[model samples]
Target: MSSPRFAVAQLDEITPTPCPCGQARRAFKEPWNTLATVHLTDIHADSKAHYHQKMTEIYIVLEGEGHLEADGQIIPLKPMTTVMIRPGCVHRAVGKLKIINVPMPPFDPADEFEV
Candidate 1:
């Protein structure tokens, strides 16, 4: 038998975890597959400002309205709005939103820093 070259994850089956932005269900989080990870996040009102040193996060708003505060700038957001946040940029989402976030180089719990 040959080993599968790709990995599959059921996003709905993945458990949601508390994150800086809200609750998130992440997929493709294996250490060996470190290229990227996909996250479905439900943004709450109390999202915190945080930065990642080695990961670049791309956020795509799937529902609701909001604004992204990134490096002292506020960017308005709505459904279909996309924002790419680079390493070292302190950012957070305000307002109710459901977003799909893709973290390049994958996401590391240790790399997240609160600012």
Candidate 2:
């Protein structure tokens, strides 16, 4: 019999993004259409406001405090807080924030939409 397509793991794999702010991805390719465990570290809100064309995302605070602006509303966030971002939703996090970002369809820089 063939082994399962996916293997067990103690920790997920992480890939870094090319932005002024720090961005890392934790997800697998192919068959699986969803992406997960993106870490956004020490970045300004304006630096992260770019949108994704084929993906939706959620941001959960791991450390520090900040504000999330989504759909024209400002929502205050602290440790353990989470915010859901729909595809094409204009959103950004303010202040020095460390967050866990999860995106569906994975994140492709070519698919990003800039405001």
Write model 2 residue lDDT over 11-71, tens digit each, in one string: 2344455553455544444345444434445454455666666777778788878688777
Per-model TM against the reference: 0.93, 0.71
lDDT of 1 by residue, 19-100 (tens): 9888999999876785899999999895999999999999999999979999999999999999999999999999999999
Instruction: Using TM-score, give the best candidate's number.
Output: 1
For candidate 2, the per-residue lDDT at 36 reads 43
lDDT of 1 at 100: 92
Q: By lDDT, who's the top model here?
A: 1
Work out how many backbone clashes candidate 1 has.
0
lDDT against the true structure, each candidate: 0.92, 0.65
Mind sharing the TM-score for model 1? 0.93
For each of the candidates, give the backbone clash count: 0, 0
